[model samples]
Target: MAATAPSQSAPLAALSSTATELDVRDMVEALGAALTDAGIDGDLRGSITLAVSEALNNVTEHGYAGRAPGEVHMVVDLLADRVLVTLSDSGHGMPGGALPPGLLPDSSGARADLPEGGFGWFLIHKLCLDLSHTRHAGRNTLRMTFPRYLAPEKS
Candidate 1:
């Protein structure tokens, strides 16, 4: 699906906080609530939550590496047919100052020897219909959109 802007006058949710695990969790929960309020449910909601969590976890782990955590912001907008999420932080830009290629990791080895991580960008790329990143003036911004897999609201 094409990345479309929200038709509504306001975003479904927005949050800002110091880049920390707890703060990330809270912000993601807030997004989940907003999605629920917008009548999104089932796997789409879970996919959005997971993608946002991975993005936020990246901020906590890599963005703030070797220094005090900085501020992070998340804005969620519900379009008629998709959801847009923008996450920004005043920390390190992506390695090499660009978004990763998001190549899937090698998983052909033994289960015990598989990589413990390195799937964040890959999953984000897979889940989002569109994704982009930018770095300017000591800040990084990631924008992504996911198709609304919309399930009917249960009575």
Candidate 2:
């Protein structure tokens, strides 16, 4: 089958942080600028922003919560029709180094018992074309790929 998106051959782009909320914000801004600099279209920009934000939030809140200072590293690879984001944190890994199987966020359920708005993973799964996670040697890594044309062009 023919590919829907253009090809990519760009070099990798990277950012490092301490996994704090402020640092995550800085990284997000920097990455957004990087995407625009690479000629990313607007709609895809929004998706990438949301996905990256949620991912970073998870890293700070879950992976590194209450831990000693450590680094959260992110690398971006921009291709003609896609972007790949790899985020790594030197914090406690998930049990057995595996991401919990992604679930449909319970946000839509009418069940009163389900807590509201734990929607980061759900948004990440829906917005990104691909998502994967791993942990080894005490570092957790999340890699997400997003298609360039997910956003419609501005009229």
lDDT per residue for candidate 2 within 1-155, as digits (tens), equals: 66545334444568898888998999999988888887784778888888899899888888877876578999898766677899998887765667655566655556786766577777787787878888777678888888866662222
lDDT of each: 0.85, 0.79
Model 2: colliding residue pairs: none
- What does the lDDT come to for candidate 1? 0.85
lDDT at 54, model 2: 89
Q: Relative to the unseen true structure, what is the C-alpha lDDT of residue 74 in candidate 1, on a scale of 0 to 100?
A: 94
Model 1: how far is 31 from its true place, Å?
0.9
What is candidate 1's lDDT per residue for 1-155, written digit by digit as tens? 67654464588888998889998899889888888898887888988898889999999999999999999999887776778899999888888878888777999999998987899988887778889999889889899888876531222
TM-score, cand. 2 vs. native: 0.79
CA deviation > 4 Å runs, candidate 1: 1-8, 150-155
Candidate 2, residue 26: how far the Cα is off, in Å: 0.8
